[model samples]
Target chain A: MTGVETLIAERSASATAVIPDIAHYLLNAGGKRIRPLITVAAARLCGYEGQGHLALAAAVEFIHTATLLHDDVVDDSALRRGKAPANQVWGNAQSVLVGDFLFARAFMLMVDAGSMRALHVLSRAAAVIAEGEVRQLAAARQIATTRDQYMDIIAAKTAALFAAAAQVSPILAGASPRVEAGLEIYGRELGLAFQLVDDALDYGGVAEALGKNTGDDFREGKITLPVALAMEAGGEAERSFWARTMGEGVQGPEDFDEAVARLKRHGALDATLEQARAHAARAVEALDAAPDNVWSQSLAALAEFVVERAY
Target chain B: MTGVETLIAERSASATAVIPDIAHYLLNAGGKRIRPLITVAAARLCGYEGQGHLALAAAVEFIHTATLLHDDVVDDSALRRGKAPANQVWGNAQSVLVGDFLFARAFMLMVDAGSMRALHVLSRAAAVIAEGEVRQLAAARQIATTRDQYMDIIAAKTAALFAAAAQVSPILAGASPRVEAGLEIYGRELGLAFQLVDDALDYGGVAEALGKNTGDDFREGKITLPVALAMEAGGEAERSFWARTMGEGVQGPEDFDEAVARLKRHGALDATLEQARAHAARAVEALDAAPDNVWSQSLAALAEFVVERAY
Candidate 1:
């Protein structure tokens, strides 16, 4: 992980001042290394000690960081990871260009990872992530967004990268295709569970704990699973309430409390957590093919922690 | 070029509706395909006849297209290629995401080219292009920008990709190292020539003819060589005029005309053209190491056409 950090810091450096400035700002913002952690664990569990894993880890982080920067801009977000986003700090134009710089830099780092197969996986995942984002945008505020649709969105936007990252270390290690497939399932399922918990926390958790204000998804007219489920389970009154706040984009100050109250009344947050738990269990189950090593054990614990964060 | 277009259309397709929708719109907009032309010319001139060159050509165009999409958003322009830009039609958020999709798709195509060396060249160029864009933003509207600084910006943002695209086909062809380096120089210098002509035409060309409104750089306070030269040559009143319009970010409708008059009076446009001509000649000269085939001759003529656009 330190090697990954070192590679990130070194690779993100550029003669262009704002390229480094914005990259440093976003990269140093204390982001969770969940993706890199998965890559490292997979490497260790698969008995790969080559330095390519570190570079792959760094490339994965770069992909994550670049997407974060662009997502902030696309969402017009003001803060990320509890501090001012790079877009807000540097302005949108520089943010966009710097995001591009980081993205292009990620491909270069992947090349350095020295596996064309891993490169293909990561690059394809990147394209899928972009597709997922576009689909999510098209579905935003459309209240009729289905659970299946929402799942597809998350699978593409968030879980695909996780799957790709997990697949990389094993591919680099020349591990069996079965092992690679198992780790990939582990990653994708864990990512789905993690995102479900995140979406649930947005409706149920405190702002300080979450490092961002609650009701942002609500405010942005973003339809996550909980909102979709609640909307589905509710009657006319609930539909109109959601329609006014999210569909019409006309939220008053007190509207968030009402939204939350409705979520609680319908037990949507609990159901969402339920969905998350099932996914986490599947993530653990996917690891049955791997050896019963401490790394795999740590991975199972991490899956549990992801769902626990909802509490 | 048709093969390149076919590949772009095929690769940009996604299960998500808007991914294909926006991509189709941008890729179908009758772009000049000059980058593909350059790639094909290089490949043919160097005695290469592989499908990898076609994939590389498509990848090169994808990189160019992706940058153009991002550039339109970063500039917030309303028009591209004589039509409403993708950002305006689909909105900025979708434009940004689709741009990412195209960029990632470019890498996939490059990987399909089956040459890691070419992949490295294009990826590094993409990063440099982003860095150049950021550097341009940092140097934007600073009336005191040096000529050398202006050169650096264009070289990175415009010429680097051209150079990369030029190098790819030759690399796939397994041309001699000296020939590879020579083609790279040809590409970079031709790109420099192309961008210089673009800048000059932005000041001197008509809006309808250029497919974009002139005076955009003046309005955006983008410091190009002509603007730099005009700023340096101006008197006290001229300085204040430029300072007010570009430096202070204030522009009136009449200011564009007055700015053009100043450009003519200072011979800034002509001097810029001279600089472009020098680059074009250098571009042609760089191809001397290659076979004296029609393709190389066509490249030389294309360089002339690039500079001729300014007139």
Candidate 2:
């Protein structure tokens, strides 16, 4: 099993029994487990061997799970990973509170890592995660969302933890500042690539294949990269379509299809894919500072794999 | 002005502002500003004269506000302090994200405080707050909720922060361990009293008088101290009433009135009040260890005031 799978198997029982039933429901349902992979791989590449990385890996997973629970509630999403969301199965109140629990549990795991540096990095990331969510909420589907604004949102909500995962492992492993920065850059780029592709997939990928409800961003009226690019590229027809579909709640599934078509027609999805590729390249470039070894190669390979996934 | 009042005045602004109005919204919205008061009051009593207290105070408030936003979204609460809740006014998505922003901003304020000790205290409290929230959700309407279970919940959610606020100030002031422990105990007692009275007020106070929907806990089937005590004392009649009302969310205004009458008749409400009084006494006793001074007196007065308010 992968480090993430191993960590999940170890802690899936007993330690979090209060939330176990719901956690089992969600964890078994499906997810990429990409965040935890990033954490473990980063640690391995940084030459960490004290087993503290296992706790940190679990912490990353917990934080990601917490965000998903809150996200489902915030978006009022009924479905996730081709299954009923935790909020849908249990209720918003339970999902939200449970999400809080995971966040707390994650922090506890970090504390167990026994480094003030780890605490500082993770805490800052936690705060940034919240800020990013807020900024995204404020931006919503505004047609005026600048690239800078988009960068800020993604940096906080998506990349911050990934960067921390990469940087912290090296820091704990007693890597030099230069090595830490390289890993930080690698994780951040990988995160950016992952998020960009996610945005694109929401606009273009098959729902069943992706294991999630596609065109969800459009349904939520979220001004993601593809939609922004499509609006910039498309004529008045596309803009009107975007305007109608990008409201707080979905009007219907029909609108989603129409919006997706508009995105494809404008080459917005392709552009987003290219953006992901660019970040993936940057991520690979970041690992050059690390000494050449099997672990570094694996880390480099993982970044490519993140971008290579079709769904 | 009082230290807390001055802090509030310095930060206060109207919540009504456009997106560009970050600074304004950051400052205002008429929070009781209780956390800062606790922090500042503790600092002063501990003989802290440094400016570090100001940032810590703001950090605590930010954390509280962030949780409030998340709580409103989680509860689907429409109103807060007689105004439309963040979720209601800005939508759940906005509220959720903005709540995250506040959480992150709180960390920034703490980082500004520049004390690793302060950060450790606050970050741990943040995690505990989330844990308490989860515990409350898990324990909701659990008729068998033990006193220990309830204490665990409050300690994580409420007393943790109180302890952080009180103890952190003394630590920053370089006070002795005895002084820190004294302040921590004081804050704990105060928080317990405050939460207990809050439970009482939900059932005993009027909606107009409290400026919040009265008996919300009952309607939501939240097993608070009064409810727990009532459950323990209740005969078959009360048990049936609880069975029909709790978790069913079927309690109307008349049902609320009937529930209060049951509590009063069973002497649960009185018992709870006595408990609150005991806690208040403990809170005051905690101040005895501090140097006899105006700040210590204000803290004692504040402890009394916390239980006195119906709202």
Candidate 3:
């Protein structure tokens, strides 16, 4: 983890003054670093003992940070990781351009790893993630968004990176195809679980615990799992509220509180947690195909920990 | 060229609705198509008869179009290719996300080419281009920018991709290292000439001919070559004018006319054209290292044509 952090700092330094400053501002800010951790853990689990994973881990984190920078611009976010968003500090133009720089830096890291297969996997994931963001943008504020559509969005936006991060490690380690496939599935399921918990937390999770405010998704009118579930279970009056606040963008100061109350009444948060738990369980089960080692066990424990954050 | 156009259309067609819509909007727009033409021309110059160059040419065009989408957002332009800018029509969020999608699609095209070396060249160029953009953004509205600094910015922002696009062709064709280096230098010089001409055109070029309004760089306070040269030669009153109009963003309706007059007084426009002509000569000279062929002769003519647009 320290190596990845150091590498990120080293790679982001540029002749252009603001590029490094804006990138490091986000990189140094506190987050779980869960994506890189998964890459490291996957490599260790596959019985790899080399330095290439550090580059891949850093690459994964860079890709994640780049997305966060762009996502803030798209969402017009004020804060990220409990601090002012990069876009707020620097203008949106700087934020967008810096995000592009970091993305380019990520590919440079991958190229340095000298693994064609890894490059292919991660590049494809990059595309799918962007596609997913567009998909989510298209579905934004639409009350008719189905649970299945939400799942598809999250899988591409969130799980694709997770799967690629884990899958690349096995490729670097020269592990068997079966092991690579197993880890890929494991990472994908775990990522789905993580996103489900995150979506539910936007309504009910503690702000301090999540390092972000609650009800952000509601304010943004993001149609996450809880919103989808609540719309499904609500009556005509409740549907009208969602339509006015979300679909019609007629949100008031009291709208978020009332939306949370409605979510509770519909058991939307709890049902979302239940769905997350199922995916977490499947994540652990997917690891059964891998060798039973300390790294694999840690991965399983990590899956549980991801879900545990919601409670 | 038609094959490249067809491939770009095919590859950019996505199941995600907005991705294709915005991508096709820019792809079909009547830009010069200079970058992709370089790729195809270079491939044929290297005696490549295979169909792989089609994918590569399409990939080059996609990258160019993707940058255009993002550039429009960064510059907040109202028109592109004589039509409403994608950001203006689709909103900033859609434009940004769709740009990302096209970038991903460009990588997919490179991957399909099955050349690791080509991927590395293009990916590295992507990073350089992004870095150059940030550098340019940082230098924005600063009239003190030197000719050397402006050159560096355009080389990375504009020339890097041209060099990479040309370099990749020889790699795919299994050409010699000397030939690759020669083409790379040729493309870099050509790109520099192209961008210098573009910067000059913003002041005096025809809007109808250029497919966008003139004085865009002046209004945006972009520190292009002419601005730098004019700043170098201006007296106290001229310097104050530039500072107020560009540095302080205090432009009036007549400011652009005043700026152009000052440029003429300092011979900045003519001097800028001279620099572009020098680079164009170097581009043609660089190609002499390669085998003498009809393709190389056409490339020389293209270099001349790139600069002729300024006249």
In order of lDDT, best first, we have 3, 1, 2
Per-residue CA lDDT of model 2 for B8-73, tens digit only, reads 344323232322133234345555777788899888888888877887887787677767767876
C-alpha DockQ for predicted model 1 = 0.84
User: lDDT tens string, model 1, B1-311?
Assistant: 77877887788888888888888787888777888889989999999988888888888888888888889888866468778888888888888898899899899988888888898899999999998888888887788889999999999999998899889888999999988998999999999999999899888866787777777788888989988888788877778888899999988878889999999999999999999999999999999878899999999999989998777
TM values, all candidates = 0.98, 0.85, 0.97
Candidate 2 second chain TM: 0.90
Task: Please list the residue runs of candidate 3 whose C-alpha ends up more than 4 Å from where it truly belongs after superposition.
Answer: none
The fnat scores of all predictions, in order, read 0.82, 0.41, 0.66
- Can you tell me the CAPRI class of model 1? high
Q: In candidate 3, what are the lDDT values of residues A1-311, reduced to their tens digit? A: 78888898899998778888999889988889899999999999998898889899999999899889989889975468888889989988888888887887787788778787888899889889999998888888888889999999999999999999999999999999999999999989999999999998888758876778887777777899998888899878888999988888888888899998999999999999999999999989999889999999999999999999998
For candidate 1, chain B by itself scores a TM value of 0.97
DockQ of each: 0.84, 0.35, 0.72
lDDT per model, in order? 0.88, 0.74, 0.89
**Model 2 chain A: worst 10 consecutive residues (lDDT sum):** A9-18
Clashes of each: 0, 8, 0
Query: What lDDT is reached at residue B195 by model 3?
Result: 94
